[model samples]
Target: MANNSDIKRRDFVKTAGAVGAAAAAAARIQGAPAIQKVKAANNQVQYGMIGTGGRGQYLLRHLNSIDGGRCLAVCDIYRPNLEAAIKTSKDKPKGYLDYRELLARTDIDAVLIAVPLYLHFPITRDALLAGKHVFCEKSLVFKPEEVHALRALASSRPKQVLQVGLQRRYSKFYQTAKQMIEKGMLGNVTHVYAQWHRNPGWRMRQSPDPKRQREWNWRLFREFSGGLTAELASHQIDVATWMFGAEPEFVVGVGSLDTMKDGRDVYDNIQLIFNYPGGRKLMYSAISTNKHLSLFQGTRTEFGEVIMGTEGTIEITVGTDDEPAIGLWFYEPGPPKVEKAAGVKEKPVIAGATLATTGRGQIGLPILFERDLVTGKESFLARELKYARLWLYKRGIMVPEEDRNPVDVELDEFFQCCRTGARPKADLQVGLADSTAVILSNLAMDEGRRVYFSEIEKMGRTPEAKGRKA
Candidate 1:
C-alpha cells in the first residue's frame, strides 16, 4: 500500500547502505576467485542475422559491441530492417531478401534468428541443416511438432550448439537463485508469482493499407504471434520452470480482450496458475492495461519474479543482459504473528541493522536489505539451508553493471556457442518447454477449464502438428 514516492524513498536508503552487502554477494558468486575472462574465446564467430526487424536490429547493436563476432550478412523481407542492420553493423558483408541466401555463406559461423514466433522452427531447423550453429530467440517454435523436430535436430548435431534467446538463463542473479533453491534457501519453496504489465501492445508501422499494417505488426494476430502468451508470458513461464526445477503438470487460466480492444484478435490480458510436480505452483498474470509494476524490491514497476517458500521468500529481477545480471534477495517469509501472553517486540533484522521503522519513506531501486548476504561458500548447500532462516532475518539488493546490456550478453552467448561449440543455458528444450506452456495455458484459458500438461503431451511433439495451435 505504499505510494510510489514512499517506495522510492525507502529503497534509496537501503541501496545507499547496501554497497558492501552487494559486494559480498558478488564475491561469493565468483567464488572469491580471480575473475576469469569469458569473452567469446576465439572471436572467429562470423554470423549472419535473419528477420532484421526491431528484435534483429536490437541484437545487431549488441553483436557490434561484442569483441569477436562479426556480422557477415543481414536478411529480411523488408528493406528498412536489412538496411538498418547494414548501417549498424557497418559490415557490407552481404545482404539478402531471402534468409536462405544469407544461410549460404559458408564462412558464416552461425545464424542469429529474430523472427516471428511462427517462423522460429523452420528458420532454426534450416540454419542447423545449413551446417551452421544457431542463436535463435524464444518461444523456440510456434507449435509442438517443432519441439520434437528441433530436439531431434539438435541431438543429431551434438557437435554444434543450438541456443535460444532466453537470456535470464544466463543471468547471474537467477543462477544464484537457482543455486539457492537447490540448496533449500527458501526452505520448501512451493509457490511462485510472476507478472508483466504493460500499457499497450506493440505499435504497428504505418502502411498504405490498414490491414496490411496490422499484418506487418504480426504480434497482434494469432497466425504470427501467441498474443500475451508467447510474446510476454513466455519469459516468466520459463522462470517458473527454471526456478522450480520442473515443468508444470497442469495449468488453468483466463484470457480476456478487456483491456486493449484495438481490433487485435489476441487477448490483451491473461492470468494462469501452473501446478508443477511435488505440489509446487506458479501464479502468473500478464495484462496490457497499465504500466504499474509489482516486482522486485517492492520499489520499482518491473518485470521480475517472487519465489515463495516455507522459511523465506526472495524477490528478484534479471539484471541487464550484459556482463552483470543483477538480482536482489529478500528473506521475508510471511507476516508477523501475535503472541499475547508475553508482549515482545518483533522487528526485521537485516545485514547488521535492525530495521524497525520501515526506514521512513520509499524503497529505492537496487535496494538490498543488508542482512541477506550469508557466506554461500561455507558449505554450499548446507549453509544456504541455515542461511535461508537467517536471511529471512534480512535481505540483499544488487544492481546492474554500468552500461551492461542483456541483449549484448545474449548475443555474445549466442556467438560463443556458435564458435566454440559451447552449449547455452537456454537451449532448444528449454525454449520449447516455455513455448509449450504458452500454448497450453492459452488453451486452458480459452476452454474455460483446467488443462492437464498431459493433454499437451498427448497432442504431439509439435502441438501445432497435433492441431493444438498457440
Candidate 2:
C-alpha cells in the first residue's frame, strides 16, 4: 500500500510535469481544440443569489474566479447568512432578508439558488416566474409534484437557462470515462456500486430555541430534508444512471436510526439496490459510522463509485475541498477461452470465490484526460512526455488530475450559458430524474418494500399531500 508521502509525491510530480513535449504530440495526433471563451453581451451576466447558507457561501467562493457573471444581490431568511453572503460577494452585492425582494430586482438577469432541499422548488419556481434564468443546486425538486411542475414551468420558459448543480457532469475525467464506455473500452457494463459514509455523520447544529433547532438541523427531519438519500446518494445515483444510460426500474432498501440519538427522525444507516432493465443493478449504501472508503486502495475516504463491466471496472469520485477528483480503471481477469464439446454443460467458474476474495491484488490504471499546450499547438515532445507520465501512473509513482476543478467550471458554464443562451449539460430533465431517484429511494426505505421508479409519476399528485411520516 502507498503511504501519504507516496500519494503527495504522485500528485506533485503530475502537477509539476502536467504539460510539456509529449502533450503537444498527443494534441497534434488527437486534434487539439481551442478553448471557448464566453462573450458576455454587456460585460457580464448580472445575477442574484438566494439562500446564503454554507452551500451558498461555498459556491460564492468558486464564483469569485468566474468573470462571466456578476452578483448584484443576495437573499436569506437568516440575518447572519445574509451578512455572510455580502461578505463573500466580491461585487459587494446588496443583501435582502426575503428572497421575494431579491427576485423582484430588475437588474439581475439570472438567479443562483443554494437553499435547503425543501425550499429548492418554491424559490426556483418563483425565480423562473420572475423571468430570470436560474441555476439550482442538485436534488432539484423535493417532491414528485415539484418535479412535474418544474418540468412544465421550465419548458414554458424556453428563453431562460435552468442549470442544476450536478458538477460531475462538467468534469473532464467523467466525460472521458463516458466516452470510453461509449467506445466499448468497458464492454457491457452490468453493475455500479456507490457509497457515501461519514464518521459521526451530520453533526446536529446547536440551538436553544425549538424553531431554530429544527431549522438548523433540517437534514435530520423528514419534513425539511431527504436525509442521506437526498443529501449524499442523489449524486452517486445520478452517476450510476448516467453510466448505465437508464433510470432504475425499481428500488428496495433498508434504513434505520440505529445510532445518533440527537433528536432526529432520519436514519443513520441505509442500504439500497436499484434495479434497471436488462438485469443491470446499482447497489448503494450510506452509513454514519466509520468513514472508511472501499475504493482507490483506501487512498480517499467518504464517497466514491465503482462501475463494473465485462471488460473492466472504473472507480471514480468527484473532488472535494482538499482532494482532487480521480478515476481509476482495472481490467477484468477472466478465464482463458476454450472450446467445449457440443451440448456439454459448463459448471460455474470459481463459484466459491465471492467479491471479498476475488477483488484483490489488481493494478488500477489512472484515466488521463488533461492535455498540454506548448506555445499554442501540439508538439511531438509533449506527446512523448504524456506517455512517460502514463508509465509513471501505471507504476503508482504518479497520478494525473483534471487541469481545472469541475465546480468552478460548472459555475463558469452557468454564467456562460446565461450570456450565450446555451443549454447546460446538467439541465432540467437530468436534475428532475436525479430528484425522482432520491424520492423513490427514501420511500423504499420508509415503506420497507420495493418502490417502482414509475410510482413517482403518481406521488405528490394531490395538492398538499405528504409522504410517509418519518
- What tens digits encode model 1's per-residue C-alpha lDDT throughout 1-470? 11212112124224323533443355457643121122333556777888788888887766767876777788776666667878878556567776656665576767888887777877776666666778888888887666666776678668777787887776556766788778876788899988887776565457544546665767887877888888778998999999888999999998888756666788888889999999899998887767676654345553678888886666776654433444545454345685656666666667856566454333322323223455555667776755565444233423433244555666777766665667778887788788789889888988999888777556654445457433
TM-score of 2: 0.84
The number of the candidate with the highest lDDT is 2
Q: Rate the local accuracy (lDDT) of all candidates.
A: 0.70, 0.82
Q: How well does candidate 2 score on lDDT at residue 154?
A: 81
lDDT of 2 by residue, 238-265 (tens): 9888888899999999999988998899
User: Which 10 consecutive positions of candidate 2 have the poorest summed lDDT?
Assistant: 1-10
**Whole-model lDDT, model 1:** 0.70
The per-candidate count of clashes, in order, stands at: 25, 14
